[model samples]
Target chain A: MTPSAEDAAAGLQYSRVLDAPPELVFDCFTQPGHLTHFWAPKGASAPTTEILVDLRPGGRFETLIVNDATGATYATRSVFLEVHAPDILAWHEEHTGMTVRVTFTALPGGRTLFSLHQSDIPDQVLRPENRAGFATTLDKLSNYLHHLADGAKQ
Target chain B: MESMLKNRPPGSLDAAFAALADPTRRAILTILADGDATVSDLAAPFAMSLPAVSKHLKVLEASGLISRTRNAQFRPCHLERAALDGVGDWIEDHRRVWDERLDKLDQHLAELQGGKEERDDS
Candidate 1:
């Protein structure tokens, strides 16, 4: 599926079809027990040490991941923006000023098509007055980089 | 994700973030993105004085976001492509982490269903 204009401006989008029902996949995001099982990257663990999931609009959703190789800890403190059970979940990450939206579409065979869209890369860095200019400049910068890369190949 | 980004040399990404925080500095980078510009050319867009613009340029240079040529008469400011790439790297890092996490989720779901199947068989 095509990403929204804002997401296409400066965002990341990912989709995966999982072998689980929509409710089960949704539960994996809202429930702390299920979230802790797979909320971390490889070589890191989301230790069930301090996970708080308040499943409602404006509620808190936090997770702490510890790097196994370096013994470092990364904490995510975000506020839920939308929480529709068995369907859509979205949150605003406090540290990065990014909004993450996840949707679960139930498939025919009881599977779930999970989609994630993350945006607002320039939110924290740019002021409201500068957003349009910043976005346009980012687009220019991307084009310039592409031009440079193309030049380097010759 | 924080740890992964921090694994890079400290202060590089932090400095880029800080450099991009200023509106004027960001505008300056935008100008440089189009083509290299002299200090006078950069200062012409804003009402700020040359020295004021120079101060901002100093910060940008320190952050490695932009560089100035060693030309004595006219040191044109050039956007450091690598530093901007570093900012893009942050997003790339997040994408990679999410990719890995989803893989873990896939495995977790399999294990969970496998257990359910075993329970149903018994």
Candidate 2:
């Protein structure tokens, strides 16, 4: 189930289907090493230089993004609001007074429904650029996982 | 711990994130994000005095969100988006993994239940 509407008004809600198990998807997120690979998709403008996430309510969620050619970091921080294993994660974003909630659901047919809903955000994150950026990242994840799944077959 | 982006480069992620955790400090960053700002310019909006704004500036400085200048002691604050890249990148990573595992679980459940339904038909 999702949070109340009052809660969502503060953020953006997003969900996507993945052809994998919840456990695997959860592992992909919880495992820092794995995260570095697919954080940003190929041909995307931004690059993920670092990702450090502690698996706890008060634990840190830190990462770094850099320009690919210049290697200049664009942003970084460790924000923590709440975390429920394999289900939800809530955190504040870059002093924007907004919060991010990432939800995961296990659907039938070996598919996982993952959604990211950010609340309390304004036009900044709502801009088309931000959404497109995230969509690109998701596309990378799908492609990478598809490759991994294929490898398992071989 | 409270200092404007003086003498320090917006060099690392940890320091940057620590500085951004506060609303006041984040406000300072937002202002800096717009452009450069003097102590007075940054403090103009808040009800607080210049000293209060300076205090926030100190923290921002430590976090690499802003930097001071040598001229006239008017340390201007600047917004540095470089340090914030990690947040979005990390979230994207988590989303990817969550997708993978959730899909796997669904398939497993369907497999178990699918066999039961098939046997029931027989």
Q: Model 2 over residues A1-154: C-alpha lDDT tens digits?
A: 1122122222223466655566766766666665554443332222333577777766776666555666666454557666666776667666454456666788997667777654443333312344444433334433433332222221
| Weakest ten-residue segment in model 1 chain B by summed lDDT | B1-10
Residue B58 deviation, candidate 2, in Å?
41
Docking category for candidate 2? incorrect
Retained true contacts (fraction), each candidate:
0.21, 0.00
In model 1, the runs with Cα more than 4 Å from the true position are: A1-10, A122-154, B1-87, B115-122
Clash pairs for candidate 1: none
Each prediction's DockQ?
0.12, 0.02
Tell me, by DockQ, which candidate is best.
Answer: 1
Q: Which ten residues in a row are the worst by lDDT in model 1 chain A?
A: A1-10
TM-score of each: 0.56, 0.41
Model 1, residue B106: displacement in angstroms? 0.2
